[model samples]
Target: MPKRSNYWLGAGLVFGAAFGFALKGIFIKSAYEYGIDTISLLSLRFLFSVPFYIFILSRKRIQEESHPQVPTITWLKLFAVGFVGYYVSAYFNLLGLNYITASLERILLFVYPTFVLILRAILLKKRITHLQWLALGITYLGIVLAFLKNFDAHQQKNIGLGAFWVILSGFTYAFYLISSDGLIAKLGTTRFTSWVIISALFPTLIHCYIENRLDIFNFPIPVYIISMSMAVFSTVLPTFMLSEGIKHVGSGNASIIASIGPIFTIFLATAFLGENIWLEQIIGTVFVLIGVFLISWKGKK
Candidate 1:
């Protein structure tokens, strides 16, 4: 593909991944309504994703074993990242979701890109441009606007706690991104993903046991199906596309493209869940898009 075409394809992949991730809220909420707790739901979701990851790895091993060599230390690093990033962050996110609106959770999660920038600055000794700083400020302003718009007197009861958890999720996700970037470079995207999923299995299995929701095995067929679809569509497919897309687009563009997630989720929520979009959401969405663009779009100097 030409350079422009590659950019478009990467943008499309990122958008699709974000859309799939947004739909994750729908499935998770549905599963929660069916009496699955946060831990249980996440456990099942990761467990189901394992096979898909294995399949991808198996294919890669057959085709390109010589291309990327993943060391034992890399596997260990991925495990730690998966544990903190995927398992812990996702658990907290779902817990927060139980208390707050999905919209709120999404806005909070969108802060991950900012966190990623901060992490890069600290860890990689990278200096951010003035425009990037301005964009970060604007994006944070949009987050505040989103919260203010959605703040309800009745919903304020436990929102503080929920906000804490959601912010923690964002931090963990940022660490995961920072830590795994090198690993992805070494292991290739598919193998790196497989190792992370494999590493996640232990934590998830322990979580399932603690939650004692193995009775998900006995849930209604539709619930089981939806959960599985959540694993495939939300977890596996998107992760693969995003990993590959990032290789093509670079993480900065991938992060900017992912800012569109909330916009897509807002529409999806309105259509299927009968949620109403407030004016604040519209304005917040624009701010997010603008902030992301400002941060990402720069002359090649």
Candidate 2:
């Protein structure tokens, strides 16, 4: 393939993955309406996704001289990341969604890009350029505007708590992104993802136990279908497409493209869920796009 064509193909994959992720939020909201709690929802979601991941891993033609063993310490680290990053972050996100609009939840979650930049700077001792800082400011202003416009006088009571959890989830997700990059380099994306999913099983199982809803056989047909969709549409397909896109376009471009997800979600929420898209959301979306572009853009003077 030509370079230009590869770039466009990668761009398309990124957009598709973003749309898949945004649609997952809609499914979560719908599942809640069917009386599925976060734990049961997560358990079923990962349960269905695990086999798909394993099948992908199994198809790799590379044969090991010996079955590659992850060291105990590495297992612990992977498990910790999975538990804190995936399981915990997901739990809080679902909990916050119960109180806030999906659009609001998305904007709050988009704050993670800024968090990623800041966290990288802190942990790696790297300084962001002036343009990157400006981008961050613009993006944060947009996020604040979106929040203010979405605020309701009647629902002001829970906004603080909801915002706190949502932001916390974003932070956890950022950590996951940063930490997993190194592991992905070492283990390859598919194998690394499979391990993380397996590690996540422990926390998710505990969560299901705490919620006391382990009876999957009792779930309604619609709930089963939606849960399976969450696995196939949201988890497996999107992740594979994203991994391929990242391979072709590189992570920097992929991140820039992925930043558009919140804007897409805002519009989707408006069209499908009857959520209002305020002028503030439009302005915020612009800022976020600018910020993401600045952070990811490369140039030389």
lDDT agreement with native, every candidate: 0.78, 0.79
lDDT for each residue of candidate 2 in 19-58, tens digit (9 for 90 to 100): 8888777778778778877788888988988888778777
Residue-level lDDT for 191 in candidate 1 = 75
lDDT of 2 at 11: 87
User: TM-scores of all models?
Assistant: 0.88, 0.90
Candidate number with greatest lDDT: 2
Query: Model 2, stretches more than 4 Å misplaced?
Result: 61-67, 153-157, 298-301
Candidate 1 residue lDDT tens string, 140-252: 88877777756653644587788889989999988997888688778767777788877887887887886684554766676777789999899998988897788778877
Listed per model in order, the count of residue pairs whose N, CA or C atoms clash below 3 Å is: 0, 0
Residue runs of model 1 more than 4 Å from their true location after superposition: 1-9, 65-69, 153-157, 213-215, 247-253, 297-301
Best by TM-score: 2
